[model samples]
Target: MEGLQLIATGGALPGRVVTNEDLSQLVDTSDEWITTRTGIRQRHFCAEGETAATLAVSAARQALERSGLQPEQIGCCVCATLSGAYATPSTACLVQKELGLAQDIPVLDVNAACSGFIYGAAVARGLLATRPQDDRRYALVIGCEQLSRLMDMTDRNTCVLFGDGAGAVLFEAVEGAEFAVDLGARGDMAIETPPCGPIRMDGRAVFRFAVDALPRTLHAVLDATHHTLDEVDWVVCHQANSRIIDHCVKKLEADSAKFYKNMDRHGNTSAASIPVALNELAETGRLQPGMRLACIGFGGGLTWGGMLITVKGSAV
Candidate 1:
């Protein structure tokens, strides 16, 4: 299999910022109560006229600009989301139109919930492999979510845990770089959104699954790639909860500092969380060429996945 090289990354959050204090007005919760539990101080919520596709277009444009690749050079586009604007056109198609990408390329959306981004990456790698090598094929993978639309304002448990945003990355196929991925899902609704209703979850069950699944998935990917935790330059897990991340880090005996986090400000943007965190790291110059990164995601569909990738260039 041809390895995948991450060329550039970009992210976009909604303009409206909802702090814990703002949420407290809707729910009977205080800042200390929310922060101590979720490690989130504020989250972005979409206002009128802003949708997942719009946010994705914004992020994707930034990624394309940073990649120095024209929109026509993209051979495939994959979007990961659970809350998109339309159930028919697919958010990927909407993004393709918004970005003015070539019509010949494959464009589709994947719904693995929070694991959507990692799943989309795996799909892009497969799609890119099938393209002619001489064509200089590139894939655009995006994770976008309008999760606030699913929030129940009165239900603090689920309402305060989500936000709206999008994140994107450009990938090119290469040889010799190591790329290994693992994905799994249990056919149960431990966390889910009902038809025409807000999000619901068995918090205890979901928390237990995340802490156990995260480290196991990380180790599985590392074993497949023949690498160790110490060898990884950064570990970017889905920004769900700080406690979940802390537990997984402790279980693996990994350096907590190597784990990048931004949920304190962005909250949980569902599928967009990982890429959003990744873009932040890249923008701040924390990411560099040739570094090894382990990315993981877990959530709704009760899905979990991890990918081991080597940084391709200084662009991201």
Candidate 2:
């Protein structure tokens, strides 16, 4: 299969920044308590009139602009999220309309919970591989979440751990070295949501699952690619918890400096976490040409996956 290079990245967060102290007024929690447990001090929440689709569109536009690619040049649009404005039309469809992308192209959404971004990247790679070689096909992959809408403000356990945001990247098909990809689901509801109820989770179960699944997935991808930890420039895991990342780093016995994290400010944006972290790295000039990144995510649906990608400079 032809390799897909990440040519550009972008992210968008809601205007309202809610700190742990802010939640203290509504719920029985303190900044020190939340920070010690989740390593999250603040998070962004959507205000009136803001929706997942809107954030997705904003992030997508930034990515498109950064890539210098016209909207029509994109061959596919894939959005990863569990929260959408409506269940009928996928978030990708709404993004396509907002971005004025080609009408004939494939546009859809996927739900892998916190692992959704990595899942979306895998889907985009497969889609781009099928396109004609003569055409310069690109896939716009986005991870957007509106978790605040599902939050039970009174439930401190869940409410303090989530935020609203979206992140995006433009993947361009290129003839280059292929990278490894792996995806799996255990069909467990350690984390779940019902038809009308707010988000609920078994915190201990999730923490245990993440710590184990994350390093395993990272090593699986590295082994599949015949690479080693020393060769990877960055390890971007779902920014669900700082503790999970710390545990995975210790267990893997890998260089702690290689792991990237931003949960301290954005908290957990579910599907949006990894991409948001990627965007931050790119904006800060940390992502450079030829750098290898191992992206992993684990969450509800009990899904976990990882993909190895080589960073390519923005499209000319």
lDDT at 192, model 1: 79
Worst 10 residues of 1 by lDDT: 128-137
Q: Tens digits of per-residue lDDT for model 1 on 1-316?
A: 6878788999999899999999999999989999999899999999999999999999999999999888889989999999997887999999899889989888999999999999999999898887776564789999999998887889999888899999998988777779899999998788878644599989899999999889999999999998889999999999999989998888888899999988989898989999998899899998899888899999988899999987787755
List clashing residue pairs in candidate 1: none
Cα displacement (Å) at residue 34, model 2: 0.4
What would the per-residue lDDT of candidate 2 be over residues 1-316, giving only the tens digit for each residue? 6777889998999999999999999999999999999899999999998899999999999999999889889989999999887886999999999999989788999999999998998898888777666454899999999999888999988999999999998988777655778899999878997754599999999999998899889989999889999999999999998999999888988899999989999999999998899999999889989899999999999999899988888322
Q: Could you tell me every candidate's TM-score relative to the true structure?
A: 0.98, 0.97
The parts of candidate 2 lying over 4 Å away from their true place are 134-136, 314-316
